[model samples]
Target: MTYELYYWSGIQGRGEYVRLALEAAGAPYRDVAREDGDRVLSAFGKGIETPSFAPPFLKDGAVVVGQVAAILLYLGDRLELAPKDERLRLWTHQIQLTIADFVVEGHDVHHPIGAGQYYEDQKPEALRRAEEFRNERVPKFLDWFETILERNPAGPDHLVGDRLTYADLSLFQVMSGLSYAFPRLMERLYGDYPKIAAVSAAVAKHPPIAAYLKSDRRLAPNEEDIFRHYPELDP
Candidate 1:
């Protein structure tokens, strides 16, 4: 059965994380909203037995899963994108959660005062937030990923174990978004996190992921997305 994924059409946002995992696994899925924008709105308005608070939800036959991490958790076993060992699987989920936190912080940099407020209205606050985010938070998050990769008993090729998992895929998406959002900042700091960089490179080269990246399905990062590139903010 082909999975149905509901997310906004034009932006990658958090939905891209789930997309990466599905693509990496070569799973058959339809990006529902891309084909029918109204479907997502209907899902939100009409609601389901188990409604997701927002888009980026998945429908698998009878089951509906919400949240990027939760959707990956549900798909991990089925797609063989998670560890078989219970402990390691949980570890993978933990890593995804951390990545989710990083994503939120990245988004907040542009809308520090409030998400509802335009970036122009909050430029002063965004500048301040971006400074700390670039100088401190980015490094801290990347450093932790580097440490995890170095400490992984299996190898540095992947995050949770010797094999690929959703965590690695999610990390790749995070790194890609960061580079797009803060190219200068990442260019300056990325070298220090070689392991994190390696993971991103590996994921990009993965046959399926590479194809997806080149495909029209992959949306380019834009100012409207969570990872926005404001030159002044980057500087």
Candidate 2:
């Protein structure tokens, strides 16, 4: 069965995480909103039995899964992107949740005051937040991922197990977004986290993921997206 994904058009946003997993697994899925913009609003307006709080929801037959981590968890088992061992599987989910937290923090750097308010309106606050995020939070999150890779009993090639998992894919996306959002900060800090860098490189080289990155389906990062790059913000 072809999976149906509902997310806002244009920006990659949180939807990209789910897209990366589906692409890595070579799953056949339809980007519903991309095909029909109105479909997202229609589905969201008319509530399903299990309505999602927002976009980036997935439709598989009758089952509707919401939230990036939840969607990946649901897809991981079926797509073989998750580990078979229950303990390792939960560990992978934990990693994805942490990544989700990192994404939110990264976004908050630009919109520190409120999501509804414009970045220009909160420029002063955003500048302060961005400095803290760049100096403290970025290294903190990257350090944890580096330790996870260094401690993985299997190897450092992947995040969870010897084989590829959704956690690794999600990490790659996070790294990519971070690099785009804060090229200067990452250029200086990324080298220190060689294991995290290795995972990002490996995921980019993965055949399916490589193809997806090159395809038109992959949207470029922009100021409007969660990972926005402002010259002042980065400086």
Candidate 3:
């Protein structure tokens, strides 16, 4: 059965990770939000039977799952984007969860006080949060990945071993998200971490990814979701 993905229609937001992975794997799936305009809100208004904690949900056959990490975990296993070895599989999940945490922190830098509140309303607090994220969190996260890549005996052709995995794709998306939201800050930091940049650029140039990126369906970055550009938040 064909898989179905649901998320906000416009910006790629959190959903892009799943989209990029699916696209790269050449898997058959429906981006439901993009397929039917207004469908995202209409379905959302109807509400989930258990109440959706958040969006970027997926439906495959009888199973329905939400949360970006959960969706990717499911897809990674089924799409062969994850390792078959138990240890490596768990490690991949661990990294993916870490990436999820990083994404949440990035979002919080913009909406430090409240996700429900506007950025303008929380500008002062947001500025303080963004500064910390820029100077501290950004380097730490990048360094963590840098360490992982450096230790990989497989020579860093990808995040895990020599093949592409969901974690690498997610990392690529995170790198892109940060660059879009914090261009100047990334410019200052990314230069120091060559492996991270190389992997991100390689993911973009991957054949299937290159085609999907060229397609109109690939949404552009905007002021929403985990990443948002605020000039004042940058140097």
| Residue pairs in clash, model 1 | none
Model 1, 58-165: lDDT tens per residue?
989989889999999999999999999999999999999999999999999999889988999999999999999999999999989999999999999999899889
Total clashes in model 1, counting residue pairs 3 or more apart in sequence or in different chains: 0
Regions more than 4 Å wrong, model 3: 38-51
lDDT per residue as tens, model 3, 171-204: 9999988888899998888788899888888999
Report lDDT (Cα) of residue 163, candidate 2.
Answer: 95
User: Candidate 3 at residue 63, lDDT?
Assistant: 79
Off by over 4 Å in 2: none
What is the descending TM-score order? 2, 1, 3
In order of listing, the candidates' clash counts read 0, 0, 0
Off by over 4 Å in 1: 42-45
Candidate 1 versus the native: TM-score? 0.97
TM-score of 3: 0.94
